[model samples]
Target: MKRRILVVDDQRHMANVIKFNLEKEDFEVILSHDGGDAIKKAFDCCPDLILLDIILPKKDGFQVLKEIRKKTITPVIIVTSQEDEEHKVQGLDLGADDYITKPFGIKELVARVKANLRRLEYLNLPKKSNIIASEDLVIDISKYEVKKDGQVINLTLREFELLKFLALRSEKVFSREQLLEEVWGYEHYGDIRTVDVTIRRLREKVENQSGKYKHILTKRGVGYYFRRI
Candidate 1:
């Protein structure tokens, strides 16, 4: 099956150029010129990945990304001209998997896209017979799924990876920075409230069980750890 890529940029030529290259790689490319259009395209295409630009005529990439994250877990990479630390940080915090500064080499862009998509794929792949169960919770790595009291929990792509990593290394306190690299599979620094954000979200799905919450605790002044409930 061909991977579909949606390129959301206001620059027609730039969108076309990127589309051309992606199509060359046998990817089906979709194009949208503004944030509003980007959102619609995202829903319609259900792309394997999205290459979104920051500046747009309507809502802008940040707004577009917020909407995308709310509705879909599809991986999105912000393709932008902004190189400032704040800009990069903002995008990542907004749920973008990665960012590429403008004037980027096409080869590098493709490589980044491949890497992220691969990460996404690995994040979703179902685990086989790999099972780790306790009295209260069950983590099946082969199934790439989790259950607490026999109820399946819904976790975002990144959230699942974070939980999996912490569970595998239970009792170890991983700093925010270390978790960022291990779970994100990248070290694009600017700011990393993302690690904090994802952890909180994971708690909601995994640890914040209505009546019985399991491990996955926060170490004040340190980071996070997983232990028996």
Candidate 2:
């Protein structure tokens, strides 16, 4: 089955360009020019992936992303013209799987799109041991679900993959670069900050308020590791 992708951009030209390229890669493309309509299409079309622009009429990409995340964990890749780190961080914090700055090469964008979809596909594959539990946290690998203290903890596809990778290794420490290669599945497409953002988000969802149970811990200057306790 050909994967469906929702491309949300205010610029019609840009949207069409992306659509044309993605279609050539055998993806079904759905275009939305504004945030409100994007949100509606996001659910109605049930896209396999989303290429969302930050600037849009009505609600904007962040709002659309927030609304989509409230119910679904679909992979979203922010397509923004802003070069600011703040915007990129905001998108990641709101559950975006990845982001690409504007004027990006069509090849690079295509590569990123394929990479995100690959991760999603890998995540859906069957696992030998479908469950991993430590203390109050339970990771259901087969179902792609995580629970903390019997309550469902919402995690983006990327965040869940990171948690699962580290959890499967228990106390093994991995550098940001190693995680980028292992979890993101790309050595050169993303930076180390992406790992940091994902780890921070994961910790927020699964950790306790008292900071007593730090499931994911930083090793000072090293990197990150999962503490089973």
Candidate 3:
């Protein structure tokens, strides 16, 4: 089945350009010009992925992203004109799987889209050992779900993948570059800060509020590892 992608941008020309290119890659594309409509189409169309613009009428991409995350874990890639780090961090913090600054190459954008989809595909595949457990934390690999103390924890695709990758290799430290290559599938095309942001987000969701359970630990200057509690 051809994957469906929702492209939300206020600029009609830019939206059409993206749509034209994505369709050539054999993806069914849906276009939305504003954030309000973007949110509605997201739920209604049930897209395999989303390419969202930060600036929009009636609502903004961050608000739309927040609403979508409340009920779904669909991969969202922020397409922004801002070159500032603050906006990029904000998007990631709000559960965006990835982001691309404006005036980007069509090829790069397509590559990122495919990479995000590939991660989703990997998550859906059957595993010989479908569960990874440590203390009260349980990661259901097959179902792509995580729970702590028997209560479900909401995780974005990136956060879940990072957690699973480190947990599967418990006690093994991996550098930010290695993790960007392995988890984000970006051997040469990502910021190191992305890993730190994702790790912080993952820790917030999986670790205990009282700071007793520290499944993911940083090794000072080395990197991060899962210290099975």
Candidate 4:
């Protein structure tokens, strides 16, 4: 299984340098000198990992990162010189798996790459086991699909996991902090707004008909629950 990596940097020398090392390690490398090219190559190659630089000719890394996320959660490591706290937080908020600063050691970069890839593989496991049917909805984890009242509902990887977590324990209340830990899989300091955003997105998909469902019920000032109503 050859791992494909997209290397996006405006600096040709830097891109070539990273490509040289990654290729030596048996990774299939795709190079893009600008953000636009990176996005194009990513859709075509579906790389296993993306090494993105913040400054680019066509668009900046943040824009590229946001767009990349819209398409796929392929493990992205921000390989750039942006060392500000805001930048790092923004990257994490955009759902980046990890962020690395410039002047990184080869060993450190490889380690971060390995860690992020491991996370993505586990999180994106096929969703088509058996149909997990509640009273009014069904989720096929292995098939990576979901439905409510027999209508297919498209879900991003995170939305799928969040819904599955709640559905598994309908009526079991979970705090926002608990959800961030259990579902999001990030035990570190993270914004609770992330939970809010994902929930809003899920409701948009699952609760389209008159906006009523007993699946996800929010507990004011406490947490949320999935009631079997």
TM-score of each model, in listed order? 0.73, 0.96, 0.96, 0.65
Which structure is stronger by lDDT: 1 or 4? 1
Query: What are the Cα lDDT values of the candidates?
Result: 0.80, 0.92, 0.93, 0.76
Tens-digit lDDT string for candidate 2 (1-229)? 9999999999999999999999999999999999999999999999999999999999999999999999899999999999989999999999999999998999999999999899988877777768888999999988888999999887889999899999999999999999999988888878788899998888889998887657899888899999987
Per-residue CA lDDT of model 1 for 1-229, tens digit only, reads 9989999999999999999999898899999998998999999879999999999998999999999998887888888897677777677667777778889888878877887777877866665687766566788887777897799876656676778888888889998988877776656542367677666666676665573446778889999998854
Candidate 1 wrong stretches, greater than 4 Å: 129-155, 173-182, 186-225
**What lDDT tens digits, residue by residue, belong to model 3 across residues 1-229?**
9999999999999999999999999999999999999999999999999999999999999999999999899999999999999999999999999999999999999999999999988877777767889998999887888999999999999999999899999999999999999999977668788898999888888887786557999898999999877
Show the colliding residue pairs in model 2: none
Q: What's model 3's lDDT at 109?
A: 94
By summed lDDT, the worst window of 10 consecutive residues in model 4 runs over 184-193
Superior candidate under lDDT, 1 versus 3 = 3
Candidate 3 displacement at residue 50 in angstroms: 0.2
RMSD of each: 4.1, 1.2, 1.2, 4.8
Q: Write the per-residue lDDT of candidate 4 for residues 50-82, one digit (tens) a residue.
A: 998888988888899889888786767777687
